[model samples]
Target: MSVQEPEARATAVSPLGTLSLHVTGASGVTIDVAQAQVPKLPEGMAVDGVMLICVRLAVQITRESPMRIRATADQDGHPETGEWLESMAFANGAGRLQVAMRDDAWLAARGVAAEPVQYERQGFSQVIHEAPAGTALYVSAAWRIDCATAAGDVSAWFAADLALPA
Candidate 1:
């Protein structure tokens, strides 16, 4: 995508209210919910009555500059600045999970450098077990773009009621 106009903000939401992402300022970034699911675990890795929230983020950063981005997912309250989940593995034998950005040739061809990344979590195990499905949970992401012409901070989040599979 092209560089966002300075101070401009954009928001996109999934059709089911399962998740969403947005951005602000001239960071030249956009976010979308690529996937949101309660993944099925392998027989041994499964935990009775427990479920996990996995969210894949489609992020595009077009501005060429070093940037620092942080992402997290959890229950109830919004994630704090320090609660960064840059890399994490699911609990209870649910295998590994991560949100990593890669170089995208598609974006590169158009002059953008970074590929979008996904976000997910089992960090709210207690909430999963205790709260009924449809309770609100949040996924937070923030970015600090450092290009000389577009130095600013942009943040995004998703506040969705959990949709647990039957």
Candidate 2:
């Protein structure tokens, strides 16, 4: 019997409601994300009056040594609404890794009241465990948005790339 080596994998979820990513120089990497809608609102705010937004991201590196992962958010809103947020870079990591964003300031700036709601970890993915001297991978982040003054949810996948430092 023979054993197989792990390869680098890239995965991500962007605020644009899309999930897309790629891995190069390695193989056998996987990613996953889970999002939840805010079911309740603060005082004087109804589900329709407040927007519930959550972004879940996770990455796992099975191989040893170091690997670089980058996440970015491009485009905002969706087919239904105009772009409300701009694309932003999120993270870069190497080795067994995990990343997420649940800052109150981030939520408040997006028009969501920074009260009465708590964010939680939602999803995760795994990167290849082993790689040669140089390896690169990328994954898009996942995004979930609850529309203000509307009752709905938006989800999609974007694109991202990875690179190994010299």
Candidate 3:
């Protein structure tokens, strides 16, 4: 068995609309991400042993539930959250309930590195935790924006099944 790392999707959205993060990584193909996560070697392939190429991003929105935030619609159709994100949890299998990045840091006090890449964006910083081989991960959250001008809350989420690296 080996490690399988998940790549970011081309596009991610929330219940509010399409999301555009100012900060992003390099193009997928250029990174050879697909080939890196494969469980088995291909025929006729030889040489070096298999190596685990794992990179995980832990994103955490710490606003309280039913929190209030300033938002405006972007051309992409998703609400462009202000300097801060509205949901304590947004779309993506990475979002954990009742758990924030700080909680993972607690492990470090016990001598564990949460392995999350801390990304500071608009309103807050998202904790991205890198998962090693044989570890399964899931992100499930429904993000709704209570836009000040709107009568109803705007909702959205991102979902994906991440397989553990073989």
Candidate closest to the true structure, highest lDDT: 2
lDDT of each: 0.26, 0.27, 0.25
Write one digit per residue (lDDT tens) for candidate 1, span 1-166: 7864332222322221122222232233333333343344434222112122322223332343232233333322221221122222221122122212221333244343333333334222111112122222224222112223211111111111122222
Candidate number that wins on lDDT, 1 or 3 = 1
The Cα error of candidate 3 at residue 148, in Å, is 7.3
- Local error of candidate 2 at residue 146 (angstroms): 9.6
Off by over 4 Å in 3: 1-7, 19-102, 106-112, 115-131, 145-166
Any idea what lDDT model 3 has?
0.25
Q: What tens digits encode model 2's per-residue C-alpha lDDT throughout 102-121?
A: 22243345333222112112
Itemize residue pairs with steric clashes in candidate 1.
57-118, 59-116
Q: Backbone clashes per model, in order? A: 2, 22, 21
Error of 3 at 134 (Å): 2.7
Which regions of candidate 2 fall more than 4 Å away from where they truly are? 1-28, 35-64, 76-166
Which candidate should be chosen as best, given TM-score against the real structure? 3
